[model samples]
Target chain A: LAKTTQPISMDSYEGQEVNITCSHNNIATNDYITWYQQFPSQGPRFIIQGYKTKVTNEVASLFIPADRKSSTLSLPRVSLSDTAVYYCLVGDGTHNTNAGKSTFGDGTTLTVKP
Target chain B: EAGVAQSPRYKIIEKRQSVAFWCNPISGHATLYWYQQILGQGPKLLIQFQNNGVVDDSQLPKDRFSAERLKGVDSTLKIQPAKLEDSAVYLCASSLDSRLAGRTGELFFGEGSRLTVL
Candidate 1:
């Protein structure tokens, strides 16, 4: 599994855009960049995933440079309800024949203030 | 579609006591996982099962923690002689087998079982 590094915490005001970056210098070719959002007392939920370049979804966008060493999760017009810890994980989503997959880092706690 | 279900939502026990958590994944899902999440830290994978068989349990503290998924449906995670550091939320997640053609592995997580060992 590839280890990921991201900010410990970030703060954003409502209606502002927030970007959380994750660095995985040792990412493998088969690894995919995935982000999960976890609220207090709840299990983490998938936000978006991408291998490279950019992928946008209804909730957020993921941007991966060609180097694949890092990626960014962009949330637009944030709301207070968006306050939660976001995790960036690198793994081969196409296969799961092994254990200890989807290792999550300390995660970036994004605090959305009104 | 029903999501992954886990219980008892919260548990409090004294040191050396034993506790168990149950989980029922969505129907037809073939893969299930157990994770432990400490306060302010990301979740750690404890075990993974594929169709009633253990796929990976490298991180499971076999000395004190045990989990089983029978008939490949519902599962149970147990902790014996609990310690104070074991006070974390146990999360259950399930995903379809990615080996299936055109399927991408996506994990569906439950509300998690919060455990506090006093």
Candidate 2:
């Protein structure tokens, strides 16, 4: 189990880029960093995931440093619809499935103001 | 492709009452999961099932909360004598594989069932 720490909340105007970073000091060798976005009253949607370096998708980009202790989620040209709670998770993806659970933290609430 | 489906998008009951939530996973998905999310918080995994068999349930409050994924496809989560703390959105997700030996794909989630315990 890896505990992730991220900012509690952030405020930004529309058309701005928002970047949220997470820290996992004890990330395991087999861990994978993943991000999720949750809109109001809806289940979370996967944003991006990466093992190391950078991974980009249509919605967001995930950046992982070489140490694997920190990761960042960059949302380009965020809009009002992008205002949601974002979660950062680090997990030993191949660990004991019986004991390994994807525990979500408080999450960073990104509020895109108009 | 059809996404995961859940029934009773909203549920309201008094404390000590019983409630149940139903979920239908994506076709051919072998793994199913249940999660609980409080207001303004991230979703928390309560249980995971692999082909009708429970794989992990460490976070589930077995005394009051129970879930079953029968036939390895659809699932049901029940709360007996629901508590105030049980007031949250119950989410269901399905994945192709989660055994750690195969390629683990992303989870497809349902709209979720919101429970309110008065």
Candidate 3:
């Protein structure tokens, strides 16, 4: 399992774009980067995932550089509802069927203010 | 489709007492997981089950915590002589399958059972 490091907290105003970066210097070739968002008293929800390059979804976008050592999660037009904890995880895409076993870092807490 | 279901939304018990939490995964999901989330921290995987079989339990405190999935559907997690540090939210999540090619490894989670050890 690759160890991931992210900022402890971030603050943003409504309608602003927020970007959270995660560093995994030892990421392996088969490892895929996945991001999840968790709200108060709720379970973590999948935001986006990518192995390399950029992957965009309705909720967020994931950008992975060529070295695969780092990845960024970009949230567009943030709102108060977007304030939540974001987790970045790296794991072997092929064998991580039981994704629960993947290690979860402390995560970045995003505070969106109106 | 119905998401994962968990029971007894809240539980309060003494440090030496025992408690149990139940979970029912989504229909057709082949992989289930039990996670422990302490306040202000990310969830930690306690165990993972592939259908009715245990796939991994390295982080589970086997001496005091145990979990089982029967008939590849519903599951139960039990804690005997719980400790103060055991107070946290117990989350249950499921996925279609573990294989990456077969699925995206996206998990559907239940509301979770909040446990307070007094």
lDDT tens string, model 2, A20-112? 999988776766877888888788887887889999999888889899889999999999999899988776332232225556798999999
Q: Candidate 3 residues A8-43, lDDT tens each?
A: 999999999999999988776666888988988888
Q: Tell me how far the alpha carbon of residue A31 in candidate 1 is from the true structure, in angstroms, after superposition.
A: 1.8
TM-score of chain B of 1: 0.96
Which regions in candidate 1 have their CA more than 4 angstroms from the true location?
A93-100, B99-103
Interface root-mean-square deviation of model 3 in angstroms is: 2.9
- Per-prediction DockQ scores? 0.61, 0.51, 0.52
TM-score of the first chain in candidate 1 relative to the native first chain: 0.92
Roughly what TM-score does model 2 have, to 2 decimal places?
0.94
lDDT of 3 at B73: 94
Sorting all predicted structures by DockQ, with the top scorer first, yields 1, 3, 2
Clashing pairs in 3: A97-B98
> What DockQ class does candidate 2 belong to?
medium
Whole-model lDDT for model 1 versus the true structure? 0.88
- Kindly report the fnat of each predicted structure, to 2 decimals: 0.69, 0.46, 0.50
- What DockQ does predicted model 1 obtain? 0.61
